[model samples]
Structure formats: C-alpha cells, structure tokens
Target: MDSGGTDIIWNQFILGAALTRAARRVLERDGEEGEEIRFSYADTHAGGGGLPVPALLPVARKALASSAWAAAVGAGDVHPGSWVLAGRLIAALGGLAFEADVNDLDPAAITAAKASREGGWVRFWSHDWFLFLRNRLAMEPRPHFVFIDPPPDDPRGPGYAMDAAILLDTLGLPYMVTYAVDTPGAQPQEAIDQIGRSGLELRGAGLERGVLLGGGAETVVLDILSDLRNLAEVLGGELSVRLPRAPADDYCI
Candidate 1:
C-alpha cells in the first residue's frame, strides 16, 4: 500500500469499495439481532486517511458519484484510505457499531488516521503487523471484518499469509486480503494456492485490473466479490473468481 504522500492508485479505490460494501453487509446482517451482533473492524496495514490521491479522482468520481460518502471527500482532491472508508461506513450505522482497531506500522500513518477522525469510531495502534495480529487474537467478540493490505515490498508477506490462516481457523472472523498484481491473472491464483495450503477455504476471490482480493467465508465477502465484478465492468477490466485448489497430497493417496 502507498504511504500518505504517495499517489493513491487504483487499488485503493477498489479497496475502499470493498470495505464499504462489506461494512454495509455486516450492518444488514447484524441489524436484525439488535445488540447480539456487534460490528467490529480491524485494518492491519491502515494508511493515513483522507490524503489526496489525484490519480483516483476520475475513477472515484465515476464509482462513488451516487454515494453519500463522496461528499465526505469534498472537492475530490482527497481520498479515504481503507480504514477511513470503513470508519465512514461504521459511522453511517450511527452508534450501533463498535470502534474499530486500526493499526499501521508507520507512526505517521497512525497520526494521520487519528487526525482525520471527527468522532471515536476508530482506535489507533502502532505495531508490527505480526505483533498486531497476535494482540488482536485475544480480542473478545472478534472483529467482524479484518482488512489486510500488506505493502508491496513487505518482507513479512509470507508470515502474514501464514498468520492469516491461523486467524481464520482460530477466530472464524471474515477477512479481505488485497495485493498488487503485476500480471493480469498471476497474483490472484497465487493467493488462492497460499490460502489452500494454509488449510482455509476462500469465501470469495476476484482479480481486478491492478488488484487482487481474497476473502474468508462470509456472505459479506460474497457481496464484496460481486461489487468488484461490477466495478470491473464499469472500468472495462476483467474480474475472475478463482477457487482454492485442494492439497496435492490429499488427492494423491
């Protein structure tokens, strides 16, 4: 993911859209149960919120023109990062949602997140991604949705992948994993294989022009997948849903 001063690429837009849709789904599902369903969110690599990413204006203008959240961005000079976008969604639900645990390895990013919020819908954390996950493991009434957007050059990518599997197995909370893809179809497949090898099933997966996303088992992910596919059509990009391949040894014997 890009830093606060970097240009906001297309991937951020896709991510914001996915988070928006997923949070809305959580609201719909949990709204009926009253206090039984507490909406919680976490972003492992949340960047600074409400930074200007001029590259995204054209796309954002098109995709979010009808969205009320668009006004939050003002004149389109600034864009919301995944955490801010999710926070906006939670804010929309009034006071029903729990304050999200938004963390970033960058202290500057954490500061930016803190500066952008008008209310207490989000909490900030400055920790290594691995340590952050370990701490969140003990959180009661686990996060309803966790967003994992590791930096492109992050050395802990492999470790994060492994930990993600443990997170799903142990907590059973849904997650949305997004990464940059150099090739059209290469990265998404690799993500599926990695998740499969980790012994978790994909709830939904999609490859948009420059970004790939994989989800854990939840209906919200399904909705997110559908929204991405629709966005692909609007952008004249391709969206492919790949199934996780079973372990080779499982079928060999």
Candidate 2:
C-alpha cells in the first residue's frame, strides 16, 4: 500500500524473485547450449540496504539446483547492503561459476557500496546504467534474462520506461520490467498495448506488487483479449501471448 523509494517491501522482493525464477526456468528450458541464463538486473533506483534475504532465499534455493544458472549484474543505486546480499546469493545460489557485477551513476552511492563491503564475487561500475547495459548485453551469448526497474528520479521522464519496454521488444530478449503501476491515466495501458503490437510478447503485466482487496489480494493477469482473469488467485498467472499479427502500425492510440 505504501509506495516510496526508501523502504524495500516484501511484495516487490518476493514477487520479483518469483517472476525472475519463473523466467529463468522458462529460458533455460528453451535455451540452446550454454545459453540457459546469465541474469542481469538494472534498477535505475537501487535504494539503500533494504532487499531482505529471507524473501530471496527461496528463489536462490530453487535456482541453485540447476546447472544452467549463471551470473548476475545490478546497476543503478545498488546500495551496499544489496551489493553484499545479491553477491552472496549468487555465489551461494549460483555456485563458484557465477559472478555478481554492480554499477551506479551516483558517486556517493558507489562509495557507500564499497565502503564496508569485503571481498566477494561482486564488482562495481560508476556510469549510466543504460550504457552499462548496452555493453553488457552485447557480450558473448547475450544476457539470457534481464530485469529493468527504472528510477523515479530519471531526468529523461516517463518515456524512459516506454523506451525500455521498446528496447526489450527490439532486443527480442526475455525480460521483466517494473513500471509505475496504477497510474492516474491511460498511458500505462496504452504503452503496454503498443509494446504488444511491437511484435514481441507480454510475459506478464501486473502491479509492482499485487494490490489488496476486501476479500484478498487482487493481482493483474490478462488473457488473449487483454481481459482480467482469476480475481482470487494468489501469485498471479501469466497469459499465453503470441507475436503481433502485424507491425506496430496499430499502436498510435
């Protein structure tokens, strides 16, 4: 219910890990040789130490059992606590082969992330997140999975998120992006419609974390017609989606 940039909430962490795990599974299941996953997460607003280990522990456990699991990278604010937490998780959950790379544009945040952090699989970069991603994604065997959580303070405006959605479409990669849910207008739906029209697919479109209703939590899940479905289900289900029948010509609305 409380939406802010400071405190890390359970819904965001839990649901995000779940979605990441599921996407990892789906990717590995369908990937080619050595292409299972090299997961990278770029959050333009990586807040201070907030992501709890308890929430991500389960996800780590599930992923550790698989040989396809690989490294992870984080960009944006990437608080030091998160740097440590994420690094430990990847090493523990991903074993010795996996690595953790982190970055941020804020010099102070970078300083904070390295101030007390000890040696680990983690490394740091101080630069624009998109530039880091551009280089990272171009590496051998492109990122098998990417999660982009754009910052609220970005000077580029709301179109940044739209551009990211389109980037995922253009890159033709399996991705999960977090946007401002339940906005004051029709633009979110409009963007989603346009992205769907871009010949890519919508793996899932839901709240940053599901919302609570009188009876229970209400999550978003869409069917082929983009109609809401399963009002009572807990973790929210993903709809089956196919590529656009035509180019993005019908997306001007």
Candidate 3:
C-alpha cells in the first residue's frame, strides 16, 4: 500500500507492511555490519482466527537468510483460525511447524485448533495466556520479539488490568504492544507523552483519526524496538513511519 493514499492510514495492512520493512531493514543493517541477527516472535492476544491482516511472518520469512528461520509462540482463543494461520504461515516460511505453540483458554478453540491438520505443527494448549507462557517460556528458546495487541479499552474502563507499556516493561524485553485508547480531544497525545520512562523509549508509532492507529476509533500503537541495543543511530536515520490522520469513518464513535 502506497503512503500517498489517505486510506492507508486506516488500512490494517499498513502495520504489516511497516513491520516487514522494519524486518528487512534489520537484515540490511546486519548484512552491512558483516553480522547476522536472527530473532524469534512471541505474540499475545493472537486473535479469534480469520486474520484478514497481512501476515508478518511471510514478510519476515521473505527477508531473512542465514539461520533465517526463527521460532514463534502465540496464545489466543485458539479460534481454529488462529492455529491454522500460524501453522500455514510457518510452513510457507519453511519454519518447523513444531516451532509454534499457540494456546487458548476455551476448550472449543482448542478443539478447533487441534481439529485442523495444522495442529501437527502447532502445540495447541488449553491454558490461559499467563499460565501458558509460564510453562512455554521455560522450555527452551524464548522469542526475542513480543507483539501484544489487546482489545480496545479505556484506561479507566471496568476490569482494566494494565496498559501494554506497563505489561511489556514488567517483562523487560523488546516488545511491540498496541492498545485502543477510547478518548476524545488531545488525551491520546497525553497518553503517548507518558509512554516512555527510565529504560524504555518509544521506537515507532501509528496514528489514526488524529489519535493513534485506525481511524473512527481511538487506537494507539507504540513499539519499543529493543532493550538489547541502542536504537539511537538505527532509528535516528531518515526513514520514519508517519501515519497521518484520515477522514473519520461513519462507524467511528
């Protein structure tokens, strides 16, 4: 999708494209330095299947070389659609199907996950995200990059646990976490201003409807590229992702 189009701001695929570009940039930098860097992916909130969004794995697969295949772990409602997509994408990328452990809390989602032939490569577990990761992370290789996309929630909304930043900060790993902050006026800017502190800094962000991420709704996406390396020169270059505001959709509220 071309950045020239105003519609791209609301298009979910832009996120995937941006991520793919970032992945390629990583490889290019590694190549330039005469060193190869490979990282795995761990995703929380894997979604209830049927992802129309562009596949991040495909782009990662397309770009990587030299120990290029990395493992992945995702936890979601299993939603059958979740495991199916993960398994296929891994296979398409020449990654071992066994490398992915996608779990869900619902028995039905688990059953759906297993029922799919893709289960052969996926470890679909009937476990909550917290419990699942506790055991999963201990087994062996831990994914280097974590992606968290929680459902839309107002910070003051009922049953709010914590923002993605706090959760990612607590994990103390490189992460890309996104949230939907439902507010009006300039409050979203205030939220972004408060995102970074001591050790963590914002690497990139997406905007929508003069807020963050997809228009018509208040969605904010903040990426903390890594704590493993200093991003000063890496991100300070001219290539910056700027998601301009789009016309609010009729469905936006």
Candidate 4:
C-alpha cells in the first residue's frame, strides 16, 4: 500500500468511528465523569480528504460531549480541529477536551486547522511521538486512552519491528489501541511472539477490516489484553482489552 492507502483502509474498516464508539462505551461503563482522557495516534494520515478523519469526527464529538476531560494527540499529518470538534461537541454534553497533534503535520492543513478557531479544543506540535510519549509519561499524568496508528511500512522493515517493540514496552501504561494493516511480510503473530518473548502474553485478536479486492488487503485486530494483564502481574498495574465485534464476513487465509 502507498501513502494514501490508509484512507482506503479507513473507509473499509470503519476504524475511526468504531473506535470512538467503543471508547465512549468504555468511559461510560467506568463512570469516568469529567476525567482527563488522553489519546495518542501515531503516523496518522488524516486530512481534508482523509477517510478516517471525516468518519471519526462525529463519534469523537459524541464521546467528548459526555466526558469531563478529553484530549486527543495525534502524530503525523492529522488535522487537530477535525478531531477536536468531536471532543468539543462531547464536552458540550458535560465534558472537557484538550486535543493536539505533532508539528510534523502538513503545513497547509495545519494552517487551515489553526485558522478554524478550533484551537480551543486542540493543539499541534512537531515532535517525534516516541520521544514525546516517553517524556510526557514521566512528567505528565498517564492518559486514559492512547491510540497508535503507524504508517503502513514494509513488514520486513526494521522500523515496524522497532515500533512494535516500543509499543509492547509501553503497553503497561493506561488504555492503548493500535492499528495495523494486513500485509504479507507484516505478520501480527510475529509481533505477538516478540511481545511474548518480552514476557508479555497474547491476549486475543480481532478483525479490523476484510479484503474487498485483493488477497492481502485484510486487517486483523490483535488484542493484547492478556499480554497486558501478564505484564501488569509482574509490573504492578491494571490492564484490559476490548476487541471490536467481528464482521461476519471478515476472514483471512
């Protein structure tokens, strides 16, 4: 898949909307009233024409409306306000929102987002997400929610493994969710094994998207809740996993 491939996947998977809805349900179940919520999205390829951005906005807005403190921090080129609108809308429903994105966002898009006066609900930054999270987690309060949406990298590339490793190590932190597309070389099972070697267990796996055209276009949702639970047992913390309800037609070879 190329740079714009995520947009296609976004539409096929309905990820943004589904995740937002799931998050809202989780928050409500926890009775998390007006509490600060943090969301970190990696390698976000969202923009004016991006499918995930437009699809996610409404659901996010609804979540923001019901929460006390809700913030979203996206890495890469996602528009801040588009997401912030969701948070702000949610805040209006008796919640609060603080959204921001890394500075490496598209220049034109960033400018447009800035001019939208949606800054009140969001902030943008140009920094490396790994470094940012490492630093922030140390000084800032742990976020209730974290989303990792890395770009579609060659599965054989070291970058994918490195990023996965970092995520596994960082999983002990609050609630976290990540997205990965199905590719030949990028085996989710391999990633799970790697995490397990680090003493983490493989919780469960779910279906994110199914193939619409090609054989390898399917996306699998690997739930690491069991792994997180194992890690927490040794590390001392709480962890959980929630898989999206699988579509009846979602299947892989």
Candidate 5:
C-alpha cells in the first residue's frame, strides 16, 4: 500500500488503497444490488496519480457502466490514461467515482475522462475536499465508507491544519479510514485523541513503516467511529476498537 513516496501525501494514497479494498469486500458481501459506493481522493500528485484510482475502478467497471464512473473525474494534467483506467475499473466493479483536488487540474484530463463516456458514473471536481464532503452528506446518506488521506500538517513540512480539522469534524460519520504519519515528537494518536474529545470513538490503529535499511518511519492508520463506550470511558480520551476488519487485512500492499 506504499504510495511510492515518503511524504504523508503519498501515505494518504496508501491509506486510500487500503480503504478502497476494504470497501470493495464490504460491497461484495451485499451481493451487488441497489448498492452505491463512492471513493474520494482529496489530494492528487503526479508520481502517485494512478495509485488510488485503480482500486475502486476495477470493481466499478464490472458492476456498472463505464460512463457511470467516468463522468466524475475533474479535468487536469493527470498521467496519460489515468481517468480511462479509473473508469474501466469502476465500470467493472459497478460503482461510481468522484475525484477532487484543491488545485485545479488540466482540462485535457477532464476531456479524456468525458470522452471515455464514463462521465455518468465518474466525475471530477476542483474544490476543497471538506466542503465537498459536507455538501455530499447533505444530499446523500453518509457514504457507507470514507477514506480521508488529507495532507499532513507537520510544521516542518508542507502540511495543512484545515484538512485535519475538516476530517476531525467529519469523524461523526459512521465509518471512516484516515492516514497520519508518526514523526519524531508528533504521533497520529494525538490527533485520534483530539477527535475523541469531540465525542467520536477510535476503532483501531495500524502502522505503515518503512522496512528498508535506511528508509524513514512508518505511517499509521487510525480507524475511527462513534462507539466503544467502555473503552472510551477507561482511556479518558478516545478509545480504539479492533473490528473484524483488521488493518492487517488490507494494510499491506
């Protein structure tokens, strides 16, 4: 699930891939009728542009029409065939797709996605992810599953508190999967604690560390929800529960 980069942005893609796979299994269990799944990636990068797109696309294409998933991707200078591959994947899985970026994307990217005739099932937007989520929630049921891989807010590097804040606020939703790195003196557990203070329960946490000789520390996945009353009481902050859906199930690549 490594996003092929060291930064947290790359880590988000790793988390996205894991969550997408988990959601796919959950969707498969429902027998594929009257079920709708939406996958969102808040940030986009050239190096890892195609990472998260493939996971949900394959399932979507099999379950739905290519146009159903292709209409949602925004136009941008994404890698060649990125949107088409994504549409094909979504159509195969019979699902819908939505991708947004804080920064605007190249029109050619949007044009390619539209040209593929997947625009009905897929669409792209250039906007803040938090706002997009908020708006979507107002119109639809809480996404059965959500992957929040916002950019990190480390002061030493390119991080954004607003992204974390938005996610923290949205944690009230039923099921969510998020990515946070464990830097020196900065543990993602603290963020989990903060979210707990706001009344959400932390379900579980998984670690994604560098295994190579000289690679950096690992990124951790904090599975959260609004349950586990006893654990929350004992911990005095936020308590994490280990569901049947263990991080190890999809944490590895």
Candidate 6:
C-alpha cells in the first residue's frame, strides 16, 4: 500500500464518507424515540491532528488539491488527521450531537489529537487499542460506530485479530475496519474469509489504494457502500464493492 500521508488521505476519504452515513442513521433512529441522541464514535488508531501539505508526498498533495478534502487543509495548509477530520465532520453534520473516544499508543499522537480544536466531546487516550476495545465492551452506551485502522505490517496486530470483528458483530455495532493489501505481512484474503466465517455478510470495498471491510445492519452497510461508490465516481478511480459471498469462496469485488 502507499506509505506516508498518502495512505492517510485515502483512508480518511473512505472513513469520512462512512461516518457521514452512519452518524446520520444514529441520529435518525434516536430522534424517533424523542430522546436526545448524542452519537458516540471510537477510533482505535486515531493519528495526529494534521500534516503540512508541503510535507506530504506528491500524490497525496495532488489528491488534496483535486478533491473536497482540500477544505480540511488548515491555516498553514496542513491536512487534518483522522480524529480532527472526524470532529469537523461530526460538527458539520450535527452540531454538538456527538462525542468521540480517540486513542493511540503514541504520546505525540494523543497530544496532537487533544490539542486540535479543543472540546470536551473529544476524549484522548493513550492505551493499547485492543485493550481499549475490551474496556469499551462494558461501556453503558456503546459507540454508534467504531473505526479501526491498525498498523498495516504488524503480523500480531489487533487488526489481524478476527475475534475483534466477531466481538463487534456480536454487539450489533456498525464499523469500518481497514487492512492493507500490498504490505509484506498483510493477509487481505484471510481477513475477508474470516469475516464470512463469523456469519456476518461481507460488505466491503476494494479500493485502488486500500482495503476496507465493513459490516452491521443491512441498511447501514448499504449506506456505507453507497458513499464509497459516490467517492469512486468523484475521484474517477476503481472502488470495487465486494458483495456478500459464501465463506472460503475466492474473495473478489
């Protein structure tokens, strides 16, 4: 997969779209109950606040210039990171209607995330992501959506843990879990097959630059994939929607 900030840009592009659709559904559902809905979001691998545009690779900078993401570029032309983008997106979609649990093992990342657009709604934590998820299992109100973007090359990383997906599925949570395809230690097919084995219908997109596997209620999955297709149209790139298939079948888009 592409390295440096290029990968981040592409990853956030899909994530932003996914969250937009998912968050809206949360509000709509809770609104029907006449109860105040404060949408909750959890990011397992929330990175730093932003990156200077000039510091990004040529391809990343090109993507920023050519897409709506340029609006995320800050005062110094810094591209906002995932957490910052999530905060901004949520704010625009539903003001003060959301709270986020953004965590990372890197102190620098946590520090940056806390500093970006300070607000009580965005909580920053320094902890192992797997432990974070385990703890969240007991949360009184589970997050409406979880975004998992684990380290791409670590063979023992939590992203490679199929049981994590099973756990989320059991909770009936909507999530977008990303994995890398062109990396040395990445097992893309195994991850897909494992999701099927979990008895969750396969709902994912094979992006030209990344791999995203998502699952949840049927309506939620359709919304996420619809946003992905819209992104493919805008970017003029191939975002192959991987439809549901039997477990152990050859994974294809």
* lDDT, candidates in the order shown: 0.55, 0.40, 0.35, 0.35, 0.34, 0.59
The 10-residue segment with the lowest total lDDT in model 4: 211-220
Tens digit per residue, CA lDDT, model 6, 66-183: 4334444444556777767776777666533668888788898777777775443877777778788777757868888787777554465634544566567566787766654444
Error of 1 at 113 (Å): 2.5
Residue runs of model 1 more than 4 Å from their true location after superposition: 1-38, 63-75, 182-230, 233-237, 246-253
lDDT of 1 at 145: 71
Error of 1 at 180 (Å): 3.4
Model 6 spans > 4 angstroms off: 1-4, 32-36, 54-76, 118-120, 158-161, 182-185, 194-209, 217-253
Task: Estimate, for each residue in 1-253, the C-alpha lDDT of model 4 and write its tens digit.
Answer: 1222323322222233333543454356554555755433222322332223333333333433332222332322443433443344334434334444433335665565455444334445444445544544554544433333333442333244335444634454322224333445535444333333211111223223221111111111233223324333332223332222233123321
> Whose TM-score is higher: candidate 2's or candidate 6's?
6
Which residue pairs show backbone clashes in model 2? none
Clashes of 6: 0
RMSD in Å for all candidates: 6.4, 10.0, 12.9, 12.9, 13.3, 5.6
Model 5 agreement with the true structure over 1-253: per-residue lDDT tens digits: 3322222222232233333454355457544466565543222211223323423333332332223223333333332233333334444556545342212134554444454443434335444545444555554444433333333442422133323333534453323333333445434444334333221222223323211000000111232122223323322323433221333324321
Candidate 4: deviation at residue 23, Å? Answer: 5.0
Model 3, 171-223: lDDT tens per residue?
54444434333333223333333433211222323322211222101222333
lDDT of 1 by residue, 190-243 (tens): 545544421211122232223333353333344445545544544444455444
On TM-score, the candidate that comes out on top is 6
Per-residue lDDT value at 39 in model 2:
40
Q: Is candidate 2 or candidate 3 better by TM-score?
A: 2
lDDT of 2 by residue, 197-228 (tens): 32111123342432111000101221112221
Off by over 4 Å in 2: 1-7, 18-44, 47-96, 115-120, 182-186, 197-253
Winning model by lDDT: 6
Alpha carbon lDDT at 5, candidate 3: 19
Runs off by more than 4 Å, candidate 5: 1-17, 24-29, 32-120, 151-187, 194-253
Report the lDDT of model 1 for residue 131: 73
* Worst-scoring 10-residue span by lDDT in model 3: 210-219
lDDT of 3 at 222: 36
